[model samples]
Target: MNDSDRNPIEDTRFGEITVRQDGQNGLEVEGEGIPRVTLERDPESEVDRQIAIGTRDPDRLTMRIDGLEVGLKPAKGGLTRRSYRVDVEYRGADYRLVPDSVPGSRLTRDGVHIGDFSCDGDEIVLAEWKEGADIRPEDASIGYALASAFGTGGQPMWMLLIDAVGLATP
Candidate 1:
């Protein structure tokens, strides 16, 4: 098969934001008035992922902005295959992308609710943004990446109980 025929294009959009996955490498996020962003899995680190702002890849957890090294630290989740959330430290701020009741996730900064991430069919949507939220493109990109990599909602309580029961039996 040809390269184009091998990779199926999946494009999703809500408002000005758009996310496209080519069924191969990773997804690219684009929106109005913001730079395009791309996220790809890290082959070296099983638990780590990489993001490229525009077309640059500096490192797994670091992205250069305006000639300054912007550190992106993985506090928890998203870095692992089984994680249900992503707690990140970026630009001296703590941002959390957590699963929500909407079968999606909520984004918060320093414990303050900022926005929600949801999916419409194959399209990932930035559902809601609270008041006074700057809602940077980078943050939205990361949030979507977290949801795509890990998942939106976590496992049910019954699943956990079943795992516990299995452990007790053995």
Candidate 2:
């Protein structure tokens, strides 16, 4: 869908942000203080999955955001759990995009909850955000990456059902 066709996300810090699919494996996000962000999933990642942000080196699985080279990795939650983790690399900086069992994910810095996002239909809504927290373009970019890569829309109904069952089990 075109940017005009997609619903814009109203964020507290960035204002109205638009997200759209660039192609089969890429997503584009636009907003204030946020450069037009693009994330592309590597196709030959049957074993080692990776995402390339903007013009980052695909082989390195790392991207430069605001002068910091960040590494993105998807770790399996477990054999049964469908959740995954995205880790950003920096000295003493612990950034993670932790998925909620439902539709979206929580952005945590050093294990502190700072932002919450949810998927409603085709739109991603920022449910909650901590005031005065250091908001950066990379933060929103990571959220879009997670939603595009691991959101419920990409899963089959049967897999979703299994995930629901798994959540209910423990």
Candidate 3:
């Protein structure tokens, strides 16, 4: 069979974000309820426009995981499978977000770097914070970034992220 006949693989899905590895080694994703999420390298710069399953167009990815159906899924891909990652900086600290699994660690809405929130094996360190005090203004922005980062993978957590940051999930 020709290379054109090959297909890509969907790597991960946490909340609303889904990761797919194009057979060509390219990575893409689909954003479910996030209306304004995009690849922005820097907050001060324009977002990096590109292709994703539903990040830009939700209806575009329907046929999608709807109807709440489940069945035998394909085995996990090789270690080298391509995927996407996002980085967020809040309160002078940076966090890397990847499509893995987290054991439900609670990150404060005020941006506290308590420890690492692990997804499968990958994780990001949150900067430590003050003990019981109203968060600074920048902390709100941090909360939003963390939520957006985590929301790129699954469902309920995505809503959690939105609520944590006061950003609308729809």
Candidate 4:
């Protein structure tokens, strides 16, 4: 059958857990299962990537990312809820600006602003310059600066400070 015509049912292992994909969007597994586990996808969201991390057997941590859900196997030490960091990369730059970094500051190829933005293990927090401001794909200067700052590995003091100060003619 063609790719689109194929409603393939496949069983795969995520770490030590087993997962069965009913089709393209439905999933089931053998376990106690998580409570109220729902997957949400926001294409308009800043981050373009999503993933679910969980463990195998008795204790499972399942997360849905990019409209798909996956299971993560616990490390050797056993099941432990670990925080994963997701960085928002826009236009070859991070939204969070790091002070005193190389390339000075720049944007990504896709015109996405790289920011110190991260997901706090539960929710994704995107970098916001102004509350109501919308990010344009064409203008990547600010995004680039932010990405560069984040790559430099420091809290986005510069961007935060700049945003706090508002616009100035210098």
Candidate 5:
């Protein structure tokens, strides 16, 4: 998948995005006319340090991230097909980000169920106004346990956008 035209590295851009493919895995995006960009998708961040009763606790968390699914349709004479699904649980709520089904409602990547979108010349706005039901664990301490259990975390939005743009561009 590495193109020779990309001498030292393979890179492509659309608008303000410059992407470099990561073999068959995914893409790395950068600003077109700027330095590298790091997208911070962690709502609570990797670590929150403060005095917990004049002390401190090392904060940790993990996200249940799934891999991409791709295949070929049998009935369509070997036509290629792809689907993207991302599941994230934060603050006792489940956030699922998948492709907009042809007959489905709207949702954003940040786990907003009911929302509105507006467009201008070169900008898009997305919002979820509905206060959906809250999801909680059986035991309140389970969240904390799981949070500290995983040393690393998953970046769902980063995965979705990188996969979508990478697969589509090249």
Candidate 6:
């Protein structure tokens, strides 16, 4: 079989975001909730002719932008596997958003980071926020992990749990 044929595509949705996995090394993303802005410039007008065009597009006006990246490799058992890392960035905004497995961690609506769960050894753990005081293995949630990873203010209860359970590598 050809190398391209060996790879498979996958798709999943997290919250309002729809993630598409392409051929073990490609990702195409499309969503309906992105905020956007439209600006119009008149070719006939000089510097004073530039005017702000308003767009009713649902994606306009959002603080975050979505994008994708991919990496592929050969795993054991002759299986071709692709690793995908999804990320977001906050433009002109303070605070970084990341994924967490610890319970009670706060999830920010204005930050950007990867939010996903991975298997570590025999348990599932959040991929990001490896060093925080809010990660808890037992009560892990997307929100709590964000709080711990980004330091959004929360008790260290989850952190202790994550430490006790031991983090797994993805």
Per residue, candidate 2 scores C-alpha lDDT tens digits across 1-170 of 34547677787777777877644445666677665655554544332233222222345343344435556665544332234555665446677766654556677777777777665423454546777777666567666555554442234446778988999996
- What is the Cα-based TM-score of model 1? 0.57
Per-residue lDDT of 62 in model 6:
19
TM-score for candidate 2, please give it: 0.62
Q: Give the alpha carbon lDDT tens digit for every residue of 1-170 in model 4.
A: 01232232121211111233322222322222221122222323333122222211213333332324433222222111111112233334333232222222222223334323222222212233333344443222222212211222223445646765786535
- The lDDT leader among the candidates is 2
Against the true structure, whose TM-score is highest? 2
lDDT (0 to 1) per candidate = 0.50, 0.56, 0.30, 0.27, 0.26, 0.24
**Candidates 3 and 6: which is better by TM-score?**
6
- Give TM per candidate: 0.57, 0.62, 0.23, 0.18, 0.23, 0.23
For model 6, residues 1-170, the per-residue Cα lDDT tens digits are: 01222222121222232222221221222234322211122223333111111111212211112222111111111111111111223343232232233332222323433233333211112233333333322112222222211222222445546755676533
Candidate 1 local lDDT, residue 87: 68
lDDT of 3 by residue, 57-170 (tens): 211121112222111111122232113333344334544333333333233332434222323211122223335544443332222233323332333455556666786444
Clashes of each: 0, 0, 14, 22, 0, 16
What ranges in model 6 sit over 4 Å off? 1-17, 35-88, 102-106, 109-170
Clash count for candidate 2 is 0
Instruction: Report the Cα lDDT for residue 89, model 2.
Output: 51
Ranking by TM-score: 2, 1, 6, 5, 3, 4
How big is the RMSD of model 4? 18.4
Model 2, residue 32: C-alpha shift (Å): 2.0
